[model samples]
Target: MSKILLVEARLHLRDGASLLFTIALPLMLLVFLGRAAGPAFPALMVMLSVLTLSFTVLPTVLATYRHQGVLRRMSTTPVSPLRVLAVQLLINLVVAVVSTGLLMAFGPGLPRNLPGFLLVFVLGTAALMAMGLVIAALAPNGKAAPTIGSAVMFPLMFVSGMWVPREYLPEVVRVIGDYSVAGPFARALGDTWVGQAPHLPHLLVLAVGLVVSGALAVRVFRWE
Candidate 1:
């Protein structure tokens, strides 16, 4: 497992595009948009990092591995195919953590409610990653994964107030955003960023999303 993890981490490092998008892009956006975003800036940066990994990086890598027979080859080895999936998840989790640290260190401010922020971050990331796994499971080929992921990502981002402030969104849209995983995740992080405990409803939504999406991904995922 350790050997596979090290090898996979090296491969991920070599994917310059994914590294730039996942780590560098968020920081760049923060420099340009932080003032406009106000206190929510850190939350937005964190969300951007998470979404990039969940929608763009995770699914694309898994789908590409499947398409190129990497997973199949692993299945034939002594190592379990499931171990690869776990390793990928761990690697992405580390990236997200590092991204968050950078945002807090170099960006505008720290998360005021550290414990609450951590709680929301964990549930939210797991839920989003589970959704990405679903995309990976359903994608027909490597090329199709990003297409499908982007299709899903943009709408969720809009609803989550990535493009527009939540205060400015239509009432109907706000309500829909409240229930969406990205929505609650954003709101929860925002709450914690400002020193408030995350809303119970947001936490519940994320928890439910994690359970349902995780189950679906497990059921639908293919080793080959």
Candidate 2:
């Protein structure tokens, strides 16, 4: 497990240029936008919201393995497929922590509240991880990975309140975005990062989505 985790971690850090782009580019964007937006941006809140994708990396990577038959090869060995999945998840988590550390190096100063912020962070993480599994299950192949990733990510960025705060969006977009998985995710994460309430709707939608997605992943997943 440790070996697999180490290998996956290194791959993401080194070979996975796309992962770096997804992670670092956003941080840079947050920094620029946070500065540009001034008090308008809510830096910590938006920064925390990016973690949704970072956390999902493990699932996506695992999907790559499944789509490529790497998972199937691992299954023929003594190592259990479940263990491989566990290690991949652990690697992704490490990446998330490391990524968070890099962001906090210039965290743009957190808001006064701590507890409310933490709740949203935890909940947002859960939602993101669940979505990752859904993608892993649904994606057709390695070539499809990036497409699926972007499809999920783009909407989350726009609808979830990350791109434009809910208050700023037009009523129709806001109404739709408000209930969207990403919007609530952003709302919950935004609130928590700034030390606010759980934004229950966001967390609940995510929770429900995870449950549904997880079931689908199990149904469709192949070691190969």
Can you give the TM-score per candidate against the true fold?
A: 0.97, 0.82
- Model 1 lDDT tens row, 1-224: 99999999999999999879888989888877888768877898899899989987999989999999989998888988899999999999999999999888888768899999999999999999999999999998889998999999999999999889989999999999998899999999999999999999999999999999999999999988
Q: Which residue pairs clash in candidate 1? A: none
| Candidate 2 lDDT, 164-215, residue by residue in tens | 6667877888877766666776666555555566756766776776577667
Among the numbered candidates, top TM-score falls to 1
Candidate 2, residue 169: the lDDT equals 76
Report backbone clashes per prediction: 0, 4
Candidate 1 structure, TM-score to reference:
0.97
Task: Give residue 10's error in model 1 in angstroms.
Answer: 0.7
> Runs in model 1 with CA error above 4 Å?
none
Q: Scored by Cα lDDT, where does model 1 land?
A: 0.93
Cα lDDT, model 1, residue 68: 94
The models' CA-based lDDT, in order, is 0.93, 0.62
